[model samples]
Target: MTGAESWAREQGDAYISLVSRRAGEFYRALANEDAATFFKKPL
Candidate 1:
């Protein structure tokens, strides 16, 4: 995770990840906050 964050920093980009609902707790524990909620729909 640190490596990924560092790479993002080097590129001057924000570190973003898509995590499953079940893993939300784990990511939150790592100091990551929920940036947005995504929803899906049948087309």
Candidate 2:
């Protein structure tokens, strides 16, 4: 894999953690029932 892709894969867990946190922020702004859209989309 390319260097960036390898790095991302190595840090994939961290990336997902951050994305979940962001989704939580969005959920707080909107509502829990509708937050799936944010979480399901690829970052």
Candidate 3:
């Protein structure tokens, strides 16, 4: 994670990843915040 973040910084890009709903709390506990929320609709 550290290496990836560093590389992203060098390239002037944001480091992001997707976490499963079950693991959301785990990542949040690490001080990572959600950049956005996704929604789905079924026709």
Best by lDDT: 1
Which portions of model 2 show Cα errors greater than 4 Å? 13-43
Candidate 3 global TM-score: 0.53
Candidate 2 per-residue lDDT, tens place, 1-43, comes to 2465458788764332223554566744543343233435568
TM-scores for all predictions? 0.72, 0.26, 0.53
By TM-score, the best candidate is 1
Residue 18 Cα positional deviation in candidate 3, in Å, after optimal superposition: 3.1
lDDT of 3 by residue, 1-43 (tens): 6787788899999666775668788888877788777788998
Residue pairs clashing in model 2 are: none
Candidate 3 positional error at 14, Å:
4.2
Where model 3 places Cα greater than 4 Å from the true spot, the runs are: 14-19
Clashes (N, CA, C under 3 Å) per candidate: 0, 0, 0
Clashes of 2: 0
**What's the distance in Å from true for residue 20, model 1?**
2.5
Could you tell which candidate, 1 or 2, scores higher by TM-score? 1
